[model samples]
Target: MISEKNKSNRAKQQTNHTAGRTSFVRLRQIRSESDEHLIDFFKEVRWSKKKGKFVTPATEEKHNEMVAKYSKLEPEKQTKDVVASIFREVLGHRPGYARGLGEMVIPESSRQNTVEKFAALTERAERHEKDAEYYKNQLEELGGNVEKVLAKQAEYDKLLSSYMESQRQTQGESHRETQGPA
Candidate 1:
């Protein structure tokens, strides 16, 4: 039931296709692709149709070129590149390379690392909350009279700093006198 054109197309597709599957199917290819294979795809590909936005044929060539070059990379370089791509956004600013900032695809590997980091951050925030509550309860137990004590504490801190500064100046002058002008 296959027409000649269909047969020719199938034959063409079967040969030199990256994985015996033509690039016709989109995101599904990403899932079946190897770990090393996806880094370039993530680099070049973005959301097509994007809820009625135009599809770009531009990234296909870039993707193909990256894939071709990827096989030549040393294993260390490959890992470094994959890691840089995966974690670049959270670490700092880089204009357009961050994960959530643009349409760049996030690697599946980042999930656990991201979750662990977020867990630490939330734990610190919770500790701060608990500390604040403890301080509030302690203040309430002492008739909530905190302003005068806090003001005196601030004055004490300033006086302590001034005293330390004067002591440092005195020691520095004595040491300089002993040195007798470098």
Candidate 2:
């Protein structure tokens, strides 16, 4: 009972809806790629999905206001050192702190110290490994010796039992002769 014209219009609408969804997905992909670049640029910052914003120390203005407030305090209460301390407390430390502390220093001594410590640790590990292998070999040798001793003891037990049986038979015969045919 559907009209031919209405059916063609519905088909056209479905095609448009699908195309719209495809375009929206592509847009999202492009946005996400840009977001990745932004995240890389702001290493110490994080994206807050709940607030829909980025949180970073560099982007904050509160620190400047706080510094000004602290600077205006009574001379006894606030000094240059006090302001610097407040700034340090507010900013804590950034990822570039170490790099900024020594701009281009190679820190060769520390690197050499670390390498020496690592080499010492590796050598100790190898020594312990060798000791473990030696102990394992010694254990195996002890086990083999124990097995040999047990086998020899079993043979000795068999021989002793045979000798005791022969002695008992000889003793029985002698007792019978001495008793005169019991």
Quick one: best lDDT, which candidate? 1
How close to the true structure is residue 162 of candidate 1, measured as C-alpha lDDT? Answer: 100
Worst 10 residues of 1 by lDDT: 13-22
Please report the candidate that would top TM-score against the real structure: 2
Q: What lDDT does the true structure give each of the candidates?
A: 0.55, 0.54
Put down candidate 1 lDDT per residue, 63-143, tens digits, no spaces. 444455655667778774554443343223454344322335343477798999999999999999999999989988776
Clashing pairs in 1: none
lDDT of 1: 0.55
Q: Which residue pairs in candidate 2 collide? A: none
- lDDT (0-100) at residue 143 of candidate 2? 100
lDDT of 2 by residue, 20-122 (tens): 2334334334555553321122222333445655343333343344446665789798654565455445435433342211223222246788899999999
